[model samples]
Target: MTELDKKINQHFGGKVVRKDLTKLVKGNAIVPTYVLEYLLGQYCATDDEETIYQGVETVKNIISKHFVHRDEAQMIKSTVREKGTHRIIDKIAVKLNDRKDQYEASFANLGLNKIPIGDSVIKEHKKLLSSGVWCILSLAYYPSDEKDASPWIIENIKPIQVSNVDIDEYKDIRKKFSKEEWIDLLMQSIGLNPKEFTLRSKLLQLTRLVPFVENNYNLIELGPKGTGKSHIYSEMSPHGILISGGEVSKAKLFVNNSSGEIGLVGYWDVVAYDEFAGKTKKSDRGLVDIMKNYMANKSFSRGTQVYGASASMVFVGNTDHSVPHMIKHSNLFDALPKDYYDTAFLDRMHAYVPGWEVQKLRNEMFSSDYGFIVDYLAEILKGLRKDDKTNEYAKYFKLSDSITTRDKTSIAKTFAGLLKVIYPHGELNEQEAKELLDFSIENRKRVKQQLQKMDETFEEVDFSYERISDGKRTVIETLEVLEYGVPATKKTLISDESSVKSEGKNVAEDVPFELEGGQKIIRDNQKGISYDMLLGAYLIGATDIKIIDPYVRLPYQLRNFMEFAKLVTEKKEPGVEVKLHLVTNNNEDYVENAKEAFEQMAYSLEALGILFSYEFDENIHDRSIIMNNDWKIILGRGLDIWQKTGAGTILTNMCKNNDCAKHVK
Candidate 1:
């Protein structure tokens, strides 16, 4: 096992199972992931290889013997009749039969209904009253001759979930893992491999869990298909239910006035609408109005009475156009039906997830390591719903007053949900708090930005915050704004001397820029930035330049190095040859190739009136560029800031050495 897997097992023993085990024992059994994992947690929640192997067989046997498959329902019923009683796993829902004054149960897969169940069982698991709950139970078959008697009986029913959890213990054990490790553990618990995602991408995945943990949190995600946007609501938790978008009505979702029975909102923690996007899809105006009210106020009225519910609403759908295309031609909500496209209805949404940023699922993205039995994680998240972290960021920063109360509430709920998911123990530093705060603002800002485009009445608000200690205001922008926004042409000089600095000032006169000495962090996947934008101004007046980067041996690394050299040549004087030296390292596999590439680069640059020299340094680790002008520029990712793109693409052109499309302000 990997060290992280071992550590996870060491701390969360008996509560975590190998994530891949769900698919192993789930052959032909159409069950939710929580149902399968609940069974796996019983026998396979161990890291030992032999125990896991035996447990897989044991779970498979149990599934084969008890779990009902619709194709074999008659055979299972025959077995139950012959044996007089049989145990099975199936989705069971209960409804009160007012005429008979008794509650009746329905087995979803067994195709049986109106079987009488005792009131005691209904009180024990009230969730069965609203929707079907996956349960393990025994059914007894009896031949009765009475006029209104039923032959099938439900006995000893148990919902497929952990009965209880000590939330304090969960919070206590959470302190053992660092924030990154804990995030990874949570990612694996959701059946995703964390190694395949960036920190930003990981946070995006975890944001899907906020609705499950926060009350009345309204979220929507529209993107390309196969990104697993609706998978969490369907597979990760029994507390949440995924329903077809077209299948919803006021009666099915809110309440049936005639029957006076509450709908899904009264029982489930979250109700997610799947396949919710299509411009041609028809929707009821009454249902949309009720949804807007419920999403904003957590209350809905079907009759004269007002009923409140805590269920969070989630909408996941597929977008027809690419992000840039939608941004250029229309707003992001263009795929929604005409009724749902209303600014008033969309304004109730707390956050809009950029589903386009999520990478499509690949085979290697599924986790095989140990993670929480999803039910256990679900229980913990449900327990955390009561704890509020709305004021958590106030300790470090204060938001702008221009933000509306609705926007603030949305940002707070998202921030609080993320905090509960990652730091249930309530321990956090300023940097961590800033990350969550910025992400929360960006999510809500995305919603508001689209609203502004759709409706001119909606005014733009400043989504910026100020630090309490230093009063440094930080502005937040969605990734799409940075990726697709207009190109920046000029850069403001930072030095007190506004006049030009000499050596190559005239060469870069058309593209004026400047730099100051400070550390800057660029987020991954952020595009339209080039090496020239960052180091060009700093390298303008230097006669001799030395770059110390230990990793310039790979093909991509060499490409990045050449790009930096090109930037230097662009910012050099017309006749003077600036001496450029590179101190990089080589390995056994690429040493010869590295030398050849460096020789070729030197020969090429010599003709451009720039003297290029390079040497190998095996032990040099830190990356920096030292110039003769007494300025040293440090690099965290060297010259490889630009992500690779297809040849001759717009991104490739915009991110080349001389392009200054996106600049750091």
Candidate 2:
């Protein structure tokens, strides 16, 4: 176990289980992750390898014996009948048989329906009245023959989830971990490796949890397939349900007028629609209208009766075209069905997570470390829904006046959801609050910007905030806007200075390259930057340059140095030699390799009419570049600033073969 894993075990003992165990014990059973983890939590919530191994085997045995599979339903039924009574784990939903004045249970995987159930059981687990709940129950067969009589009997049932959690204790324990550590812990709980995601990417993953904790908070994410957009809603929590986008109706989602029963929104905390995109997919216009009203008002009316529900809405889909293609030819919501393309319905969304920014899943991305069993976390989130942290940002900053009330509400709900996820204890500094505020504004801004492109009446508003401490205003922009909508004069292409319009109507050319000396604060997960755009203007006319960085001994660090050197060569006059020197820290392990690499770089650069030299400084810590042309550039991360693309290459400005701008600030 790593140090973080050990710390997690020490602080959250018996509450956290190795996340990878869920997949290990899950063979052919189609159950939510919480059910399997609940079983594992009872046995494997320990760091000891021997205990974990034993626990995994025990859980596997339980699953093999008790968990119902559709293909083996008849066999299990026979076993139950022969044994008189048998314990089984299956998804069970209850519905009131009004005519008989009794409740009936339907076992989803066991393939049994209309089994008589106790009234007390229905009262205890009311959620069973809506979508099915995974439960461990006893089934008996009486083999009786009577008019309108059923032999199947359910003796007892227990929902498969953490029964209860001391939310106060959970909040108090949260104080032990730092912000980054807590974020990593949450990431692991969702079966993701924190090391594989940038801070921005981590926030995007956490944003999916917002709908679970915030009432009526609508969210949408559309991107390329296989990004795990619907995985969280489907597998992470029993309180949420994932359904086909094209299969919903007013009666199914709102209230069933035929039976006068409350629908899914009345039971689940979140209702996520999977595969919600495709322009040609047919949809019920009445369903869309009801959804629009419910999403905006948190209530739906049936006849003259008004019903309210707090279920947040989530829509996850795949984009048919790339982000740039959508930005050029259509809007970011181009893939949404024609009925759902209305600006009014789209405006109900509180956040638009850029699923395109998320890297596709790989084997190594699954966590092997300790994290809260998701059921425990899900319950905690459900508990947090009672507390409103929407005004948390008001302590540090005020949003711009130009932001409308509805936009502010959307931003506040998103901010509150993120705060409840990251800082549940409500302890945060100004910078932390500011980060969440900016991120919140950016997400809502993405929705609004796309709305403007789709509809003409929607006026553009400045997505900026003013700090209470110094009154400094900061404007936030979505990554897509920065990549595609930059002014023509600021275009960074060296090959073609001409700027092309989105509609291919006109072009602007001959803009002079401009540079100013000031601190450039790049937001996290920002893209559309390159070595040329970052340092070319500053390094122009520099004959003698000395780069001072403390740690550049790693192979990837050396690659960054070489890329910078190549940029320098390309920028300088073809025939004139530019002298370059490096002052970096020495490492005993890689000092020999560094010397060899520097010698090879010197040999290569000398032929290009450039002088290169290097020296190790054990005591130097500052990173900067000093040039003889009276220019000094301070480096926050040295030359290794670009983020790693999923394709295993550095993403600077844009992808090598695609138009993805991926980087961390």
Candidate 3:
């Protein structure tokens, strides 16, 4: 077992299971992951090989016998009728039969209805009244002679979730894992390989959990699709519900005035709206107004009654346009439905997760190692909802007075949620606190900055914080504003000065250059810079160039290296050879493929009188280009800095236009 596996097994013991085991036992089963994990948690939540093998067989047999498949529903029903009594797994929803003066149940895939259910079961599982719950039910087949009489009689029912979690034991075990270990554990639990993501990317993944832990937290993520924006809400937690954006209504989300019944917000810890961004999609203005009020005040009025709910709201959708295009031609909220595009509604959002920063979901990103059973972790987050640690950062840093109360509140809530996710022990040093604080400030600032482009009345505020230790102030800017050109705002002078200072560069006639102690900061989706502009001055008179970046194995990355080679060849003497050595990690699955591609490229480069060679170094993480001329340049995202585009498109060339690629520093 790996060290992580050993540590998880030691600390969590039977409460954890290997994440891959769920997929192994879940063959052709159309149930949600939580249901599969719940069954695995019961029988296979251990590291012992023999016991796990036995548990796997037992779980497989149970699923094959009981789990209902729509295609085999008739066969299963026939089996139940032949056996007289049988247990089955299906999504069962219950409703009050006002005419019969009793509660009735419906099996979603089994094509059965009006199965008499008792008041006790309805009271125990209230969720059945709304969307429904997956449950294991025992049924008896009683053939009736009467035409209207139903044959399937309910015997016993159990919801597919842990009955209870020992919160105290969970907290004690959490203390055993260090902060980094805990972060990795959470990432693995979410089915992501922690090693593949940077600290910022990992934090972005964890930020998706904020709504689960923070009450009434309002979050939105708008970017290209396939980033798993709604995955967590749909599969990871039983306490959260994911609904389609277009399907939601005032009656379903808030309260039904006719029935006087509360909606999803009153039941689930989180109510996430999927596909929330579509300009032409229709939406009710009344629902948007109620959502805005609830997002800000945590309460909404329905006729004479005022209802309050603690469920956090999350909106996840795909943006058709790139971040730069939206920023230049329209506001970031451009893709949102007209009613939801209101400035007041946007202002109520606590944080806008930069979905563009999150990498697309790749198969290699999934973990094969052990992680906390997601249901168990979900319970822990739910338990932590009552704890208020928003003021923890205040002990080490102070927000700028220019930040409004609403802005501070949003920042504080985001910071607190992240702290709880990463540091459940409530302990963090100054630097760690600063990292989270700055991240929180930047996310809120993204919302505020975009608000300025949409509404002229909103003032630009300095999103900076002061460290209490030495009273040092650090300015925070949205990654978009820094990388892209400054937004055309009335406060252009102040924005320009802050942008220059933030990059640690001296501005001379619109050209920015690094001063003695300054370093360039590149923002995602920013444009207008080329490889020649970035590295030309440093590469002058350099004969031998060495590039070290482990991720140069991908096709796009290798293409980027070749493009950089073009720059080198353009600067070199006609016949003089400039040796370029590449040091990158050998991706085990693609090593042979990468080597072949590199060899072909090397053969091509030989014709240009540029000697190119490559080697694999497993220990390399930092990306840099070191020249024999003593000029070393560091890269944040390495050479593959351009956004992915359609093949054969003009934008395929990185240097074709300044805006063709993402910002690189």
Candidate 4:
């Protein structure tokens, strides 16, 4: 075991299990991760090898015997009939049978229905009444001689979830892990590899948990698909419910006046709408209005009587266009249903998670280490909903006066949720508090900025904060604004030179630049620093350029080199030919392919009055560019210093707003 694994096992003993064990025991079972983890928590929540092996066998046997599969339903039913009684694992939903004057159960996979169940079971596990809950059920088969009598009966049932958790003990033990360790543990619990994400990216993932811990906190995330946007709500928590965007109605989400019955919001702590962003999708305006009212006031009216609910709302969907395309052509909420596109409705959202920044889920991203069982973590987050730490940052920093009351409330709720997730003990210093505060402000600012684009009447506000100690005010900008060029309305009237002087920094044509040791430090995910901005000024008078980078063999790397060549041609005087030389390594597997690609590139560049030549150098490790005009520039990541723009994306052929490469400089 690695040090981190040992440390987590030592600190959170008995409450943690190896995450991969769930996948191992869940061979052909089509159940959620939490259900498998619940079983693991009962038997294999220890680090001992012998105990884990024995537990794995026991769990596998239990699943093979009890779990019902649709294809094998007939065989299992025959076995149950032959045995007279049997226990099976299935998704059992119980409902009241008015005609029979009792509750009946339905097994989703086993294809059985109207099986009589006891009242005690329904009262004990109430979730079965609303949406089906997975359970281990005892079934009895009685052959009936009467013409209309049925034979299936439910003997007993038990929902697969941890009944309760000691919130105080969970909070007390949180102090033992440092902030980094705690974040890693949470990431592992969510089945993500912590090493593959940045601190900022990890925080974005943690923001998904805000809904579970904060009452009535509304969040929306719209971006490309395959980022696991709905995974947490569906798999990680039993207290939350994930519903199809088209499957909800006023009667199902809120109270049904006809029946006088409360809907999902009254029982579930979080009601997440998945696949919620199709422009042409039909929705009831009344439902949108009611949702907006509930999100804002935490109450809704039914027959002139107001009722309150504590459920937070989450919306996750795919965007039809990229961030830049959306900002330029339409608003960020363009993919939302037409009725939900109102500024008033969007203003109620506390945070707009930038899902585009999250990397696509890959096989390597899943964790194999130890983490707290998700059921335990979910219970802890649910218990934390009663605690309020929204004003924790007030002791260290203050918001700008321009921040409105609504803006402050949104920021405070997000900050409090993050604090509950990361620092439940409230043991954060000024730096820590400031980090959370700035993140909170940026999230709210994202919502407000988009609101301004949708409605011009919405005034722009400076999202800045002042430190209590030195009285220094720092302004926060949304990531999109920094990535895309400043919007026309927000552009400053001053010239570039004056703007740099006023800000006391060196500013490039599009992005902010800092000089350290005569080298530029470009941040990851930064936009606007194109090839022209980086090498345009330096290569103005140079005729001969020598580039040395050993990794210029992949298709993307070769494409980067071609882009640099194009830039050199663009900056050269009319009819002037610039000679470019490249020194790179030749991989044994694709040596000939690399040679052909470079030769093809050379032939292509010659048409543009640029002569490109290349040579193989196996011993070259340092990457640098030498210009004949007495200039030598060092490249921290060679020419491939930008992320690959996916096919059919807005930035596919454009270099103005590509994401910065995350390789070390």
Candidate 5:
């Protein structure tokens, strides 16, 4: 086995089984995802393929012989009627029919419902019924030919629990696996190869599965189409049900007002809405309203009574405009239907997974390393929902007072999900904790920022906090504050390779960023940095600062940087070098080659007669780059900081430095 396979085996060996894979691997009899995974748990939980195959056949045999299908549902019923007994394999969900003394059971896929179950089924299966656990039931369907078809058979309806492949014991094993081996193993789990995706991208790719292990999570991802946004919710779990727009209703979701029938949310752990975004896609206003309440409060109203549910709500939609366009024009909610623009419903969202951040779907991202059979993970997540692990991170670090309680809850939910998914053993080293925390804050912050753009009335609150070594409380304005160790991110991005995507890309453009070296530009400090630094102290009150940066193919980045300089030096004396020198990178590949050309361009800076020269170096084999005088720009990756370069990129301003400002005749 590969090293990653070893680590994966060590960590997740007994915890999960990939039941969806059984058919492909062994051509064994097809079975429900939950049942196959359950049987695999007994013999194939190890990383050994030999054992997995053996286990696959074993599970298939169990299903083929024991599991019942719809075509035979009546046959089994007849057999029971004739013999006065029957034993059949199937999954059963029981509901307490308080109106009567018995529990009503439904056999999913068997086309059976409201069957009055034996008292023994009610007593022994009460917890599983209330929670709706997945089980392989030996049901005896009987009807008397006279009064009943026949007598019922008796047998144990055993519930199978798939132990997750053990991930906890594999901690040390992880250190030995090269990123490649680790990736390949993960790919193998998903039945893919590592060569198809980069390690960072692979992890980013895995983030979607996290919700399987987290209950009541609300995550939204919006970007260009074909990023596989609905892949997991649509295919990953038997317990997860995906509903197209037309499939959703009061009866299908929450509680049915008609017969008091509980809906999808009552039965499934995750209920997702596919093709969720549309300017005019009509939906029951009542559904959305109650959904909003249930999402936030986890309870739905029936008449005057409230019923609790734990289903996580997932909404998947396609956007016509790109992320940059939306950020420049309306913010993240730009493409959302008018009704969904409600801040009240949006606020309940835990994180906005920047769908735009992900690249278009690639064939190589699937993992082969053993991952938890999504159903097993679902059960674990549901089990954890009963526990309050949200505040576990808070004990080590606290949120700034500026963040609202709602923000805290959203962040905590995201954080709690991460903890359960990757660190369920609770052995998070400090680095691990921060990764989860930073991710949590960003998701909450994304929702908050979009809210502000939609309606500026919403106050901007910091979603970050500081952890003082001295144990003193420090309130930070943004995540930057938390990363820099001194209640700020000022010294962070430069020193920390992990801090690049701080706050977000669009908002950061307005801020003065201290590039690699200590050369600080006074940009928009409103969000990230000080305007004083991005713009020299002298330019503040000045009418204009002649800005020049040739490589700003992304109209937003260049102009925003220039205008930021103007904002910092707005009060500068006239004719000062307040005139900016953004010595452009003239190559047609400016955006791609922009960073490479910075060093060559930096050499041309002395003649620009500008105090500040924004260098674009896409290539230079060094950690250090020169700045005029004592100031030098030191970057982790140099000018090749951002991923793309395009003229229409969202960088807007009011002066020549601003985007459209220069276009005006």
Candidate 6:
């Protein structure tokens, strides 16, 4: 292991794992990442070569022996029945069975529904259960039927985490990791590879759930299909639940008025609507109203009684337009259906995840490292529902005096959820507390800022805050306080007057620089030059390179970005890093597409590790592409240089993977 890897193992090994390994240990089981990692920790915590190998075998054997793969599930079941009992690997969560006087368990992804779970499961395995939270329940079941003898017994029930992440220590430990390490730690915590991510980009990846952890956090992400927008609510942790927008009934989601039964919002930490952007999709109007109220008030009224649920709401959908085109034409809200484009409903949202900002999903996106079985993580989140953390961090920090109750609530909820997830032990110091708080504020600010653009009635308020750090308090506002939102922030703090003067001196003047071999370079327009000319020979010459951009929704757009790298690798120097400085927005609609494009590029660039990385391009107005220590190509259009392909454009005329049009203008 590298020094960093060793540190990661020491800090988060038990609670997290490498993301690539998620698939191997994960089989159809939908449990939280932490839960899987918890189990991996017990069985695979060591970095020792032999131990790591043994642990991998043990985990695979455990999954094979117990986890239900539908095809072989019957065989395993038959073995259990033949043995009169069998241990199984599955995500099992429980609820109080009042009438039966026992906690009953539901097996997630194992093809089993609610079964009679014994209290002994909790009593005997409380620590392990809590650590994994989501467990693989081992039940010994004896069938009454003679002919159809199937094993109903589950065994080796444990949480699925590989790290010992104590919530109490999250804040303290958070400070130690640079933002990159922190996210990698989170990925590791959830079993993802940081190598697959950049520091700023990781924040965008995690920003999807910033709302879930924040209370009444209303966010919307609309993009093309397959961005995995619903993954977090549905599979990342058990705290959230996903309901198809088409299937959600008002009663099932909010409180059922007639029966007064609590609904999904009451049970899950976050509630997300899948396929939320289909304007033509059928949906009940009443559900929209109830959702509007809940998003705004954090409570919904059922009949005469008003009850509140702490679940955050996220809307994920596919968009028909690109961000630039959308902005140029109508607005971000234009992607939504007519009914959902309501000013009132949109007002309730806290942030708008630019689903277009996300790249298509890649195979590397799935974790091969151990993580929680999402179902189990869901249960643990449910368990934590009652323990609110809104005020828990107040001792260490305080909000700006100007902040309102609503703002406080938004921050508190997000802060609480994250605190719950990372620092259940509650040992956060000043900086750690502030980082989460700053993030929470930024999410709300994103929503509020766009609301102003759409609705004139909404007043623009500086939603900034103040926090005490190192015996001194610093107040930051606008978007800059929350990394990557730099372009959006109105204020600028410069270290030196001369540097500031120099940076601020030019609006039209071209800056001059020299690439290696004494090649003079100058860029005048806001327009970005093609990567082909910028690093044409150099990138191709390099052995490897990575481009990091947070947004690349359209497949063609992604290809444009990848073509930039291809240009580099095609150059004179044949063995060097060809990293593309990709910076874009975050949105959900393009998850699958982005993943696909990334993978294809990876395959095509296999001979040379040509990579496309991502980072938030909030200040990307002046488009440019840079090569490692070799060159920088400034452009007017960035990666979006292609003209509308309809006027006899080759890309639109013929869309194929290896088309020459893909090589770029």
Runs of candidate 2 exceeding 4 Å displacement: 486-514, 643-665
Q: Can you list the residue pairs that collide in candidate 3?
A: none
The collision pairs in model 1 are none
Least lDDT summed over 10 consecutive residues: which range in candidate 6?
646-655
CA lDDT of each candidate? Answer: 0.85, 0.84, 0.81, 0.81, 0.56, 0.55
Task: Please give the distance, in angstroms, between residue 137's alpha carbon in candidate 4 and its true position after superposition.
Answer: 2.3
Candidate 1 lDDT for residue 579: 96
Go through the candidates in order and give the clash count of each: 0, 0, 0, 0, 78, 132
* Tens-place lDDT digits, model 4, residues 18-114: 9989889999889888888888888899999999999888888888998899998998899889999999988887767777788888889999988
Q: What would the per-residue lDDT of candidate 3 be over residues 508-556, giving only the tens digit for each residue?
A: 1123343111234433334455677556656667799898888877777
Query: Which model scores highest in lDDT?
Result: 1
Candidate 4, residue 628: lDDT: 76
**Residue lDDT tens for model 6, 57-152:** 787677667666656666766676677666666555655556656555665555554465567766764432211235555567666575533435
lDDT-wise, the better of 2 and 6 is 2
The alpha-carbon deviation from the true structure for residue 47 of candidate 3, after best TM-score superposition, in angstroms, is: 1.9
Q: What are the models' TM-scores?
A: 0.88, 0.93, 0.80, 0.77, 0.63, 0.59
In candidate 3, stretches whose alpha carbon ends up further than 4 angstroms from where it belongs are 143-150, 487-516, 521-665
TM-score of 4: 0.77
Where is model 1 poorest over a 10-residue stretch in terms of lDDT?
Answer: 646-655
**Poorest 10 consecutive residues of model 5 by lDDT?**
645-654
Using lDDT, rank the candidates from best to worst.
Answer: 1, 2, 4, 3, 5, 6
Write one digit per residue (lDDT tens) for candidate 2, span 472-576.
767676667655663453443221011111211111221234543434434455566566656776677889989998878888889889888998898788788
